[model samples]
Target: MTLKLSLSLSISLVLVVLFSIDTARAGYMEVTLLGTGTPKPSIDRFGPSTLIEANGRYFIFDSGRGVSIRLQQAGVALSKIENIFLTHLHSDHISGLSDLWLTSWIWQRQHPLQLTGPVGTLALSQHLELAHQADFSYRTKNTSLNSNFFPILAKEIVSEGIIYQHNGIKITAFLVNHYPVEPAYGYRIDSGEQSIVISGDTSFSENLIKHAKGADLLIHEVAAANSELLAGNPRLQKVISYHTTPKQAGKIFTATEPKAAVFNHVLLFGISERAVLEATRESFNGDVRMGHDLMKIGVGNELIFY
Candidate 1:
């Protein structure tokens, strides 16, 4: 073959390789655990939060404590955040909402913040607005801040169904039993090619198992069973009663049979990780991972964790 013809062919091959790489990187869902601990404060874990990136958009599930800090650590830009979903109105799960809203606004968030959750979400948004009235008023009056930037479009979920869908990303909310705190929910996000389920905070719910069925990833909450810490405190015991035990979570994992299962919002009070892992292993024959803040999963043909 002529040398010129050989050079042209080499260039064509290089272009093809580059295109293949780009295509492989696109159209996939990525999940990151922003926080993996419960309401109890811990130095290592923040609160219950996860970040989902798919279809060139970013969705956050539960803006728990330190969510903004974790998001910045994960190199997620405020501009890329399309919406925020709440599992429940539990203080631990929504504590970081204000931080995310106020801080992201300061950083020049030009679009309205989309907030979605159960029935009281609209009231919650109104409460937040009332809480920050002074700041919002002063900022807009003194600075060049556009009032539109502070606008929040809150969607109160009234029933179990598809709550949001856009750009090939669809999210569904279903009721979970975290009662006394009525109308709690679990969420399922389908990004066309792959799906993920987040068990916000619940006891054993058949509804959750139904939604999580055959998902690529399932991030569920787990509490230690009959811990010494719970024996004395009735309040703590009540909390534990409303949450799923590690073994129950394992059974849920088996029933759903996701490609991988992650235990998030872990409530470990005097219970070792070994105890929880062993309990889960009894029922779940598939991969089971304990979630930690900043942990990331890239969903492609296989689950890639970082």
Candidate 2:
């Protein structure tokens, strides 16, 4: 064999290796919506929930109705999901938590599920342990596995700080304005150079704007005034008093111009664009997108869709 031929072959091999490494690299991140409705359940909408996939792991934000099914539809296995972050303790945002806990427990992973939430998390965690006692006991006794079925590790946070981190991903939680609810939070996820922010459940709070500044993507709640305007009860009006008007959310977007903004908590501008229009009327000129149930919007270093 000629030395020149060997050198040429080595160069070819180096090129192949470099290409493979580049392909393997890339901050793979995917965001999938599980539920899009609020407490006022609608036939066309589910509750507030979202799934964040990054760096080969799944981190869920809130677990509303049909979340498990949605996750399955998104091709995410229950066993792969180990971390859950809750914005608040609202039933609409966390109603499906027990189901997630039970399903993961059924998989017998031999470890406590990671749950991060607000200050009252300890009490709620205790209640869940007690509430789901019969089911956990039944599974443990009836199954052949020898693992604790109801082991849940709770991490409660009462203030703003870094909540969770894995590999190169960082999830930082911050306080948001949602009065009467006492403590509410919004989370910013930093993976590599890309960042995404998820506003749990809050009114029109500029704190969210600040938290989500310069992020690649922002997913927050956009509430419509139609419900309050058309409802026949004062109770409905009270709900609006605490949540964001689409216009108010627009104003927030004005303050902070992110790469892209998505609204998903409630049925804000689904049927009527009145709320969205009101928000658009404000100062935000960027992309203010309306989020739907199970909708997937890719915004980051590289496009990821599943």
Candidate 3:
């Protein structure tokens, strides 16, 4: 299926209608952009991090670029973050971790930090601890930090299995498409009637669809502008070989029938002239659009109101 402009416009109109229906939902299920860029390093996009908060407990997905400060933008402090889920070991996603660790320690949280991710997580935790040796040493003397700095639980996930099950919310990690960066995964998060699947930096894969199926939202990474790569950036010609085109993403959503799709890691949403996006949208069949920083999503399928 080709992504169609008419479909995109229709989806936009639908969102406007939905937002008009209930203004309260507009406030619930806060999904904030901690960072929205990729390796390309656009000033508009930070990196690739997302924050999802509901009820009382906070669940943080990938902690990509500027995540520490991004949390401030989301209005969530370090102690509020109960669980941190990493999709892979890519630097952008995990780079902000060291800052998070230090802040959590400085704040001296009462609850233990729940750190879970694919292979190398334990090793990464080790590196974080070592990296923060100076900070930890200083904070432990503050008495408050003494009790909270080192109290953490690390759940290492090498393959697909149950990673988190607690507090009326259960999250499962499934292998995804970003190969060569082995053991990459997408997460299935279910909280009562609210369910969302997050694709952490991946190309189109049936395996991802399996995890994303029947969910309220699918947040997937979009690739570089296809036309530009094919024409302008000769350097990216080699890079584009590994990712998913918007057309392909639309097809995946068409098959998965996700209630709605919010494209992240978007290369050209508000910055470029949008010629490439028009071509990409021509391939997606259902309601499809791109996102920017602070684009919040309310719960429910296809109820994507910007």
All models: lDDT? 0.88, 0.78, 0.73
For model 2, state the Cα shift of residue 60 in Å.
0.5
What overall lDDT, based on C-alpha atoms, would model 2 receive against the true structure? 0.78
| Cα-lDDT of candidate 1 | 0.88
Better of 1 and 3 by lDDT: 1
Q: For candidate 1, list the clashing residue pairs, or say none.
A: none
Where is model 2 more than 4 Å wrong at Cα?
A: 1-26, 227-234, 268-278, 302-306
Q: After superposition, which runs of candidate 1 have C-alpha atoms over 4 Å from their true positions?
A: 1-27, 225-233
Q: Which pairs clash inside model 2?
A: 37-46, 247-279
Cα shift from native, residue 92, model 1 (Å):
0.5
Candidate 1 vs. true structure, TM-score: 0.90
Highest lDDT: give the candidate number: 1
Residue pairs with backbone overlap in model 3: 2-282, 2-283, 2-284, 3-281, 3-282, 3-283, 3-284, 4-281, 259-302
**How many residue pairs clash (N, CA or C atoms closer than 3 angstroms) in each of the candidate models, in the order given?**
0, 2, 9
The superposed Cα distance between candidate 1 and the true structure at residue 197, in angstroms, equals: 0.3
After TM-score superposition, the amount by which residue 79's alpha carbon in candidate 1 deviates from its true location, in angstroms, is 3.6
